[model samples]
Target chain A: MKFNLKKMLTTFILFFCSIAFLLPFVWMLSTSMKIEADVFKFPIEWIPSRWNFVSNYQEVWFGDHPFYLYYWNSIKVAVITTLLSVVVSALAAYGFSKVKFRASAWLFLIVLATYMVPPQASLVPQFILYRYIGLFDSHLGLILLGSFSVLGTFMLRQFFMGIHNDFIDAAKIDGAGHWRIFWKISLPIVKPAVATYAILRFIWTWNDYQNPLIFLRTDALYTIQLAMQKFTTINGSFYTLIMAAAVSAILPLLIVFILGQKHVIDGIALGGVKG
Target chain B: MPSNPSIETKTNIRKKQKNASKRRETIAGFLFVTPMLIGVSVIVLFPIVATFILAFADWKFVQSIDNLKWVGFQNFQGLWEDEKFIKSVINNAVFMLTVPTTMIISLVLAILIDKYTYFKSYFKVAFFMPYISSVVAIAVVWQVLFHPSQGPINQVLMSFGIENPPTWISDPNFALLSVMIIHIWISIGFNLIVYIAGLQSIPKELYEAADMDGANAWHKFSNITFPVISPTSFFLLITGIIATFKVFDLIAVLTQGGPLNSTTMLVWHLYDMAFLNLEIGYASAIAVVLFLIVFTITILQWISQKKWVNY
Candidate 1:
């Protein structure tokens, strides 16, 4: 088959643009592997002449900066946040979608409306509240803060609504209660949606800089994002080390994105279409 | 005929069971939502209300609730008189310029990729990489790239015979602009995906009919594609504006709103006042102002969407 000229031209243009877009990431990897002097080489080394990958990554990982501690903290916070938020949101979504109770509609509206209030608006009060409750500067505090999301509830509810009521009605006839039906029937159907929201939540919490920045004071409790900020400030002159740290920081999410590209893309699409 | 007493008793028992089950359902519903309700109250709702109240009262981080002085709009008045606050607001407005630029670029990219079946997924993932990455990582990478003396960007500019290039992130003249560029880069991925979704939803028959009417590419796009995608555009427009207005992580990581506070947007200003300065009341006022700006714009968009955003 003959190639269409317009299609070829579009492909060529898109290819070039994609390279331009991915160049920063490429540069990041390159700089991360280069020795100190070669980092600022004028010709822009796409590949370093001397690979310092082992030493650079080692310095970041095993160096005095406590990168491993921050990594563990981030992982712990993200995992707990994702799991709890997903369960809480899924339950709330099910309640709103399937269960009939007094003031349910009004309650759901309140939750949805709160999603519109930017988190920054509530920052000061939350800071004070956390301080008063003795939860300040704690991982549990960060996890709790990230656990409940109205957006998650709203998104999952849309998925739950798509489920036909016949399954629910049939389950009800079999003497299954709301909780049983929610767990045995409805939850299975909306598992993909739940997973989508979970991944998004994990990524959000892992990458979150604001909450940790405001809430955590001690270096020991710092999340990776906060740690990166501190690391950059303290070792600003070491470009290779900073880039190595940056790579280490983003590697997990990048792996997730690569492995679950379809899910991430679908999640984004779901968000757009639903909104 | 006389009614059977046993049957009547059985019917009454069944009615009681039904009521009991109904009560169980209500209890279960409440049980499922209770945790989330508690969370919303403690984390979101209470704080929002508290922030509003705090905005009217003069308080400090060091003070207790008992020492809270009721200043009633004094914080707002102070914010109005503050030069830094005014400059930050203007910076936020200027930062909003990224929304349109991002939309146009992403829409074009989406259109180009949408036409080709091959490499579509590849392009999608490539573009979206930056969006999923941590803001700190992206900021640091860009900071290196924006390095005045030895960065690739300046090096490229100098190779083209430009002796002097503006120092990004450090130069007051170009710090906001530099941040805008980074913002646009990181945002294009999300916008591209959304636009692609929007473009894919447009019915093919419209395009077929337009082709039959001898419509050219521009004509077809302007008449058919543009109007059809207006809802998606409107959605992205509102969301993009809100997201950009809340841009603190990037500022904090990259420029720290530095080089004479040229990059100090609303949320950063709020952070500085509340977290850095410990002026709780003033920060609350800034938060309220930011919320009002977002709320008003969203409401306005909702009201005006009917005029041009075709269903």
Candidate 2:
């Protein structure tokens, strides 16, 4: 009975805390569906009495600063960046781990050292270089900014190092070259780790606000983050509309979290175990 | 055994073939890493070298490189008298408090869920939801919640018989605190999930032995759980402090370091100088300071971890 009481008490406490934790999101969803007058109504309406869901959403999606364009821009930039970086990082990882060379360790240490330097510290030079190179204010500039991550390369290298040297030796004996072994043997062994990194890369790119904020100047080229900020700034008074915009911005992440929960969990676990 | 000319020739040929393949492997390895090398050199490494050099020179984005003039410690010297810069540094120091607070709360909740809760994954997902959401979206929602008059947070406060509740996000005295609250809220889930992972990695036998010794919950936790998870704490601490210095999105979306520049962080201050005021040299100085701060803190944390952290 005492054990049952303790478990019940702990569950109740955690359950309440979870509710509080989720309240903002839940409130966001609720307020998005509410009418303007109903939004600030006292006693806190958990469920909207007067639903303005369609119009609020339509105003956000089809009205000024059309979210669809930003969504498309974000999708394009994030997808291309993630795919390019993953491939580059994976190749670099395989080379550093599987292929033996004299300068390999020294080169990798340089790369790892760069990871210690925060990206914020290098913004000015990057901005200037981009302008000089005529790539400023372009999606290509934004894409290239995140296309290579030192952290990604370093992380994937650890996983690649886990693959047994025997596999590489056997592949070489079978007349397979380094590239063939990387694609066929080593990569397959680390697919889950690669996938985890790719998912993280995609999410990080998708949620990135800084790169897009600084690099892209044109409103036409704005990603969802830029669009969301602009939308909130202009519609500061319209609580319902702003909430709608917020929901629209976060919905995709929720979908991604739902779909890739296992991978995400595994990724966090990988990070923990790595330490 | 008699030396055979054909056997000796065959062995020589095999040695040459091995040498050739080794050369090929080295070339292939270089080829594989070429893209990453180029990208890092251009995007990351080159820019770092420039940031350091630019700190002593005065230049704007629109100006040509020939127009760049050396200012020689003027930028760094100016930072000493810059009130906003000083405030930003102090605000960032205040923001660092979120790390330990988040870690402690997450550790407690992690223990509760790991040891007692039934719906483990559900709880994990709930806490992690905000962490994964876009900062822009999350900040926008919080802007509404921090609404002085009609927001739910103040409304609850008002209901409890307080006549005047301090306006959050707008009041300079409370603005930094408000941002910190949101940051702590967003961070708890991530720390919680990581702590849970850390908790699971603790050896079961340790807990079993504690139970055999008739040790209480707090005793087991302090002696076993805390020490065992010290390495995890150290990891989170380092990464979390690094993250605190990089806090830009929230300030950009929510406050823009506004209401008397109370919420200004190092990154935000640097950004304002570089982009808004067109003071590239001054901003680079700020960036260099930011880098030195992070470098120093990380080294300090790494050194201190040896005192408390278990292998």
Candidate 3:
């Protein structure tokens, strides 16, 4: 095949743009591993001259603040939220799509309408309600608030709707109940969609800053994002340690994205097209 | 007589069983969504109604419930006269300029990457990395990078013989711009993935047909590719507007609406009003205004889609 000049030029341009996009992350890792003295070196090192990985990470993880505690809190909240959200959304999606109940269409519309309501609109009132209900500064509050995602239900319902009615009819004839059919037959078929939603929900919860920032006050119950802010505020001059903390905060989700790149990308595309 | 009686009894039993099963199914359906309904009521629906009501009240954090003053339209009137609220609205509009910049860059990257069969996923992942990471973490990295004295960005600028580079994230003139730059960078990856999918979905036959008609690259792109991907573009545009309008995390982390409050967008302003100043009623007014803006834009987008979007 003949090489096309225009194609080559565009490829080179994209290659450079990709580097520019990835440069901050590269710099993040480089800074995270650098000693304080080497961090401000004029040459802007891509690789640290002196590897301070162990000490930097140690300080971030085991320093004056409870970084490890925050990490665990974040993990607990994210995991619980993801699981509850997936299950609730899946059930709701199944009910909306498969069950021939009265008022189902209206109920589904209500769910869809709620998707358009920005969380910030309800934030202050929610804060008051949480405080009144004794859920203030608690991980449970965050989990409960995040557990029911209208977007997840809407997306999954689309997938659930695509499953042929014949499957449900056959299950009904076989003396199967709605729950059995949902758990045993239809859900299995839509496993990929469910998994995609689950991964997206997990990442979203893990990266969430606003909810934890506003809801949780106590430092011990702080999520990693909240703790990072506290750490930065207290040790603002310790650039090396802050970068190390930043890396620790983001590394898990980055690993998740790497492992499930297809799901994350496809889920985003699905959301875009469907919307 | 005996055969008829037995048949009637059998039919009655079958009917009763069927009715019982129908009841069970209905109960199961309700049970399935019970948790979500409770969550929506307590967390989403009730709070929304309360926010609407609270917007008109004169409730302060220090005041008791019985001491609350019901001042209809007063909070909203206050918001109208508030300079900070006006500044935030303008800042939000200025910040929205990132949407188009992000879209153009994402579209160009998508097209370029779509042309190449090699390392496509690599480029896509690289662009998407920032989006997947935490905003606080990303913002911190940017803060370090944009440091006025020691940050590599200013260092590079000085090396290129551009003297006296502005203090990004610290200077009022450049802080909002700095935040916008980061926003654009973070959003490009997600938009690129979406656009690539849209580009891929455009039928190959259209391009082949255009080639047969002796259409040039620009002609084919304008007549075929652009129209076909209009829906995706429209989706991105609407969501981007809504998301950027409510931008809080980046500002909260990086600038905290500092350097003369130049970067204070709608949500950040609301946050400061409610959480910092303990002005719940006033903040609710801001929230209501924000909701109205987002809701209106969304409805407008839906109504206008038929005019431009192909599908």
Highest DockQ against the true fold, candidate: 2
lDDT by residue (tens digit), candidate 1, B200-233:
8999999999999999999999999998888999
Per-residue CA lDDT of model 3 for A1-275, tens digit only, reads 45576666667777787788788888988988989898889988888889999999998899798588998999999999999999999999999889877677887777778777899999999998888889999999989888989988988999999999999999999999888999999999999999899999999999999999889988789999998988999987888899999989999999999999999999898888767
Tens digits of per-residue lDDT for model 2, A175-201 = 998989999888888998888888888
Poorly placed runs, candidate 1 (over 4 Å): A1-5, B1-18
Please give the range of 10 consecutive residues that has the lowest summed lDDT in model 3 chain B: B110-119
In order, what lDDT does every prediction score?
Answer: 0.91, 0.91, 0.89
DockQ of each: 0.77, 0.79, 0.71
lDDT of 2 at B148: 95
List the candidates' TM-scores in order. Answer: 0.97, 0.97, 0.96
Tell me how candidate 2 scores on lDDT: 0.91
TM-score of chain B of 3: 0.93
Candidate 3 Cα errors over 4 Å, as ranges:
A4-9, B1-22
Give the winner by lDDT: 2 or 3.
2
Q: What value does DockQ give for candidate 1?
A: 0.77
Ranking of models by lDDT: 1, 2, 3
Q: Which tens-of-lDDT digit does each residue in A157-200 have in candidate 1?
A: 99899999998999988989888899999999998898889889
Q: At residue B49, give the lDDT of candidate 3.
A: 85
Clash pairs (backbone) in predicted model 3? none
